[model samples]
Target: MQPTVQPFFESVTGTVTYVVFRSGHPECAVIDPVLNYDPKAGRTSTTDAHRVVEFVRQHGLQVQWILETHAHADHLSAAQYLRHELGGAVAIGQHIRTVQSVFKTLFNLERGFRVDGSQFDHLFREGEKFSIGALAAKALYVPGHTPADTAYQIGDAVFVGDTLFMPDVGTARCDFPGGNARALYDSIRKLLALPGDTRLFMCHDYPPDGRKPEWETTVLAQREHNIHVHDGITEAQFVRMRETRDATLAMPVLMLPSIQVNIRAGEFPPVEENGQSYLKIPLNAL
Candidate 1:
């Protein structure tokens, strides 16, 4: 069965949130939803997430899962928000504990903060099978953009999180902690090895040269035209290209705040006596 997919593009962060289900099926999954954040004012709004809520209601969908492709650094997640409003299990790759440990140490989070991925409702192992109504889905561990990155294979479509972008945009950078260029290359190969016509959905798009942002591509398109890792490009070549390009890139604007909130499953840190939650910025700690 080919599932129905509705995409909500958050232009500020160029993130794409998807609501996927089968036709005439009430159960669905929400993938990579974004929560609006204004770094300058340190305020968060649900304006973006509300769009997803509206869609679910309009379709009479029962959200079975709020899925995170990974602990995103470029934007805050709305998994918790969507779960609260729409009801679902919040899940991510089981390797998220590894990511949580690394960031916990770097940020010096509160002593009570656990790095065991307990914050999320469910942790998926590679190839684990689940269901979104009648649609069969599996989790693919594609960890290069981050140690915990996961891609969801639902029906004929795969939600590739930050692993490969539009063919013209190449692929994801691997300079972040726990990110491995070689592993990313291998992961991409695994994805490309899928049937050529398999649909691939991007979690984000950074369009260039005045083109409108696009979020869908095919395995054949990526295998043939992805600038950084087309068929003939070797693992060594991709590693070199990825490493060199990653060096020239700047840290994402919301990396600091996004990590803090994302690592906690989209909930703010516990409020202090003053009744305020704060995100820490460890100077010179990247």
Candidate 2:
């Protein structure tokens, strides 16, 4: 059975949050939900998440899982917030341990911080299968945007998080810590190998030429027209292009604060004696 997908775009961060479920079923899953953050003011609000919660309530959907494609840098995750309000297990790729390990040091997290990926309710293995109501979903490891990116394949649809963007946008950058252009090329190949008509959902969309945003496309379109890694694009060619482009790009605006909270499954650092949680920015550290 095909799943019903409703996308909620948070334009401020260029992030798209999806609510997916089998038709006629009350159980569902949310993928890549966003938590609103204002960097200038250093505050977080759940307006975006509340929209998701309201949608679920209106549709009589029971959230079964809150899934992350990866620990995102552009926007804060509402996984923990959604779980607390909607009652779903928060999950991510098992390789999140690799990310947690890297950032734990870079961020100089407290000694009590753990890198074992215990923060998430479930750590999905490559090809691991789980159920969203009656719909069977498989986890596909698609790292390189980050070491922990995983796409969820449910029926004919795949929720690709920052892997391949709309044909015009090309693909995700591979310059973040642990990101590799070659690995991303391989991962995109695996995604393109899906059936030609398979529907691919995106986690973000940055439109160009003043066009409106889009977050869904098909495998056939990607293999045929994706400017960065279409059918004839070789790995070496992709790596060179991706690396060069990444080098010219600036880090995501929310990278610093997002990573600190996201690695802890969206929980802020423990409140100090001052009774407030703070995010740290390490100087000269990427």
Candidate 3:
């Protein structure tokens, strides 16, 4: 079986959302979709989501699912918006309940907010197999970047979310809630163990100045050559480097607002009692 994937690069987030289909089939799945929001303007637009919809319509691909690798901290998900426009069920990891539990306290959400993960249609489990067209994927529960992170391995390609980045960027940080440097070390090893030629599609990448965006690479290349945490990099060394780098890093530009929306399958917070939607910010809270 063969798969066809279209990667939509969001320049704002440096995240790649893929629309993938089976050879000779019109059914498809969308991974990591983004909703276009401008904080400066406080308005939401569907430019990004519409692009994927038009592509699906142009190709006559029936979207069956909208999947999120985890609750993202960097961008608002377009999953709900796309579901409204395109018709599909949205899914996330079973451990999203953990994320919901933690963030609810952080944001002081009402007790009515369900932290049990009923928000999504499917709470996928590790090693569970699902299909997108003719391509079958096994959920690899790789959780170090986030407790709920799951990499979907379909045929020769692995949608590795933020667990691993493009080889040049090394991997995702293990400092977030439920994230662990040592755990990330073990999780990546599982991915690298795939066949040498397996394609690893990363969730995000911040290309160096003047360089073009690079978001896809091979597992063998990462196993042999990823500069930060490749085969030879020890767990101790990686943890140390990761800690040092995270110390200097400011939280993601969109962290506070994004997580609150994303954990609910990309739905915005309640329209405030003031009759407006507001994103809460706890100053110095990261």
Q: Give TM per candidate.
A: 0.99, 0.99, 0.96
Off by over 4 Å in 3: none
Q: 1-286, model 2: which lDDT tens digit per residue?
A: 6789999999999999999998899999999989999999999999999999999999999999999999999999998889889999999999999999999989889999999999999999999999998999999999999989999999999999989999999999999999999999999999999999999998888899889999999999999999999999999999999999999999899999999989888888999998989999899887
Q: Please, what are the lDDT tens digits per residue for candidate 1 over residues 1-286? A: 6899999999999999999999998999999999999999999999999999999999899999999999999999998889889999999999999999999999999999999999999999999999998999999999999988999999999999999999999999999999999999999999999999999999999999899999999999999999999999999999999999999999999999999999888889999999999999999977
lDDT of 3 by residue, 1-286 (tens): 4477799999998989999788678889999999887877767788988999999998998998898999999989999989998988899889999999999988888677899999899999989999876678778888888888988888888899988887777888877878887888888988999988888888898887787998788989998878788888888998898878777777787888789899888888778688987777776666
User: Given candidate 2, what's the lDDT at residue 125?
Assistant: 99
After superposition, candidate 1 runs with Cα above 4 Å error: none
| lDDT scores of the candidates, listed in order | 0.95, 0.94, 0.86
Arranged by lDDT, best first: 1, 2, 3
Question: What number of backbone clashes does candidate 3 have, counting pairs of residues 3 or more apart or in separate chains?
Answer: 0
Off by over 4 Å in 2: none
lDDT of 1 at 60: 96
**How many collisions per candidate?**
0, 0, 0
What is residue 76's positional error in candidate 1, in angstroms? 0.6
How many angstroms is residue 102 displaced in model 3 relative to the true structure, after the best TM-score fit? Answer: 0.6
